[model samples]
Target: MDDVRLSLREWLILKDIESALRRGRRIGGLLRTPRRSIWLPTAVGLLVAASGFLMVAGIRTSDPAVIWAFAAVWPFALLQAFRLLCRWTTPHGISVKASR
Candidate 1:
């Protein structure tokens, strides 16, 4: 019957996808997309890097002003990085509601 044939085809497609995953092949590579997706990660990377650098500099430097300024900025950079990461990873269609 046609139903059996369609089920078999779907099973074969799933099996192929499983094989590809086992082979360490990405689905993204299999289906080429035209979308650009680099900037957010780059920004996050820069923010984390800057936060680390500021932390180290604040620790090592003897000047109080320099230490205080870096201390203020570092946490903000880290928080921004975390926010960007969360935003980038969250699914577009799902809306999160706060529990009362």
Candidate 2:
């Protein structure tokens, strides 16, 4: 096991492969998104809008309602975070541009 260290070139090649896989996954996701998939965001928007209305109407137990609203918004937040992290760690000038 002590003699199994990867050389610099080997490490670079492995890194390149990993970056390529990430880019491929992103592209696949983009290509696979159907027009009907627009409904997901629209639904989420409706939930957010309803939440806002509930809050504005001074409904009782709005705290729980607001918490549910945050939960609904969380997936988008996490997706953005993952995208940011992937953009940060991946090599530049190959697949995606560096985040400013």
Q: Which of the numbered candidates is closest to the native, going by highest lDDT?
A: 1
lDDT (C-alpha, whole model) for all candidates:
0.68, 0.59
Please list the residue runs of candidate 1 whose C-alpha ends up more than 4 Å from where it truly belongs after superposition: 1-37, 92-100
**Model 2 TM-score relative to the real fold:** 0.33
In model 2, the worst 10-residue window by lDDT is: 28-37
Indicate the worst ten consecutive residues by lDDT in candidate 1.
Answer: 27-36
Model 2: CA > 4 A from native? 1-62, 96-100
Clashing pairs in 2: none
lDDT of 1: 0.68
Clashing pairs in 1: none
Name the top TM-score candidate: 1
